[model samples]
Target: MNRLTTACLLTPALLAAPACALDPQPVNIQGLQFYPSLLLGERYDDNYREAAYAAPSSWITTLEPRLRLVAEDRNSAYRLTYAGAQQTYHDDSSASHLDHRLLLEGILEFTARHRLTLKAGYSRLEETASTAIPGVNDEYSLRTFGATYRFGAETARNNLEFAANHERLRFHDDSLVNAREERDASRLGVTWFHRIGGTRALIETRYEDFDYVQPDSPLNSHNLALLTGAVWEASAKTSGRIRAGYQRKEYDDDGRDGLESPMWEIGLDWEPRSYSRFSLTTRQAYDEGDDGADAIKQTRTRLDWRHEWSERLSSTLFVGAARLRYQGLDREDDLSSAGLTLTYQPRRWLELALGYSHWDNDSTVDRERFQRNLYTLTATGSL
Candidate 1:
């Protein structure tokens, strides 16, 4: 069934249950619990011939609305969220169009810790002048039933969860040629808290399986990803983490070789002063096809620094660079990005931020040169 019908059928009955209800609260006539942000931005990306620069010179705007209603009892919770964004861009110097998106999502949680939650969501995306290039994605739906299991400290103290998600993707070009993908993903992870030398540390690890659904014609592929990470804190002002992961991707209909990639990273953090903190990170990854000789290598290094001038003003600066090499490709393209964010928070619940980013890519394919500049402004508030 569609999201609207499912919501209509489940919302009323679910709200009426006396076993799981929240504390009573006054309802806002506007249904406005909070507003996250009103964001506006502009970007320019050139050199579509060689790199992943899909568009050039685009303007953007976004608004996200959130609401929550509490019942009189202690067992039920309801949340509603909506987002709208629009973009206008120039394509190939003449083909230009505006794309708009609307998304609506609702969640109802019950039984407190048991947390029987149901979600209904829908989104509509439309492009004015593009037909073949992902113009519109209409009618996506999700249904999930999930529960958590908890164990005491002696055996394992962690939250275990299992969820099955059903999603439908309808393409604008062929309305009837719809795709339905379902995944049963589970997480087995552990978290630990410790204290040593007057400081506290937290560690976590998880393994997940992402299963997919395809039509009888065998139109898709599915795979598994393994994620593991650890964090250590030796002092009140210093902490760091190490992470390693692997993912395998396969596609049946594409007639291309499957891919397996592994990545590892290590990082360090330091707060030399109360007003500022710095972090450094390095990562390496390798992507290989079934044929071992055909492989790609990537290395990334980054540094970030943030400072607070006062209670109401703060700023952050980040710089990063990546080098990627693909087999059989003689020339390698180096990518570099840097950005700064300045924030003004006059109140605890409200904030305003402005950001700018610049990226450059030099490609060996015909010596193509690509560059992009982005500027953004955002204001967010909560009550």
Candidate 2:
């Protein structure tokens, strides 16, 4: 199955610890720093489709290439990033696919106190069709643009931030079985921060609107959220952010029911020693759904521990669990996942990692139950 990824991807259970990798030197070209990198990997998945019965195994080859250009002056900074992934299957050629993404981001320090951030991105994504059509793939395009303005300086005691974002999605309907799907989303938000010593207290409010292309679709809704949070660096060994609030979703049509939930996201990190670190992250939110399901309430929690065995070798272990509650359908799912990775950095320009992962899903519907085990070996390098 095709997956969404950037240069550094954080899987459901596993987190990336880039601090362990030695930085590769970037070349300068026309005042811009250029970085080019490539990754090659081999994977064996026993249940690639997550099917409960008649599971198929496959050996997959994966390739990814990335390019980044960055330029920064005393007043402004700009960046352009591109990445692509190609996956080919040895047993199921039909599952092989390629994905691409491009992003442009910039920051303008219009007088330090009145700064602005801008970003735009485009992605061509392919995902495996739902269980009903397990053999096919659905292709789609996503376009996004966002901006943020901050009205405070480094020494300011109080700060205010305003942000806005817009996104559009379109599905490719090149085949007879493919039906076009499209959606547009827009959001506006504001935040206030009060600085107190090494910690910052914050309050934010946001409003979002979703519109579906289908006439009078029940999926159209308006969302509102108010959150209160804090960001803190307690000491040299501890730092993190925690946010909690309430969210409500109201449908455009009165016939369909709405939803309200308590939302929270918390991430904490601790380093008892310089060579070992631990992280805990958790989140609760609502997501759109398909297949006769109107919406899904999801809660997830994960923990990661990374320990360095030596100057050049390290290991990381991650475990996570999730609960999915389906709205407008009498179905619920519990998920458990774990992963272990051993990384070796033998040279300044090369890194190798061997990893294994297990994922299990138990659902109220027997057809949705499955367990998967995957083994992978990956090598990354730069010239």
Query: Judged by TM-score, which candidate is best?
Result: 2
Candidate 1: where are CA atoms >4 Å away?
A: 1-55, 58-79, 88-219, 225-228, 232-235, 245-258, 265-270, 279-302, 323-334, 346-350, 366-369, 379-383
Candidate 2 local accuracy as lDDT? Answer: 0.80
Tens digits of lDDT, candidate 1, 1-383:
12222222233332342211112233455544332333444444343222343543444444544333433234444544444554444444233323333223333333333334345445454432212233332333333332333222222333333333333433343433233323233334444434444343445444433343434433244544555665667776888887777766555547656666776777989999988999999876543211112335667888999999987888899999987665534656687989998888777656678888877776665433467667777766554
Clashing pairs in 1: 20-75, 21-73, 21-74, 21-75, 22-73, 24-72
Candidate whose lDDT is highest: 2
Candidate 2 error regions (>4 Å) = 1-20, 129-132, 173-181
Estimate TM-scores for all models: 0.55, 0.92
> 1-383, model 2: which lDDT tens digit per residue?
11111211341111112333856778999888887889899999898877788887799998989777888899888788777999888999987889898888888988969989888888887664343356666677888888899999966889899999888876674542222236678889999988999888999998988887777777899889999999889998999999899999999999877899999989999999999999999988776554456677889999999999998899999999999888888889899999999999999888899999999999998978899999999998875
* lDDT for 279 (candidate 2): 99
Alpha carbon lDDT of residue 69, candidate 1? Answer: 42
- Give the Å shift of residue 16 in candidate 2: 13
State the lDDT at 102 in candidate 1: 27
- Structure candidate 2, residue pairs in collision: none
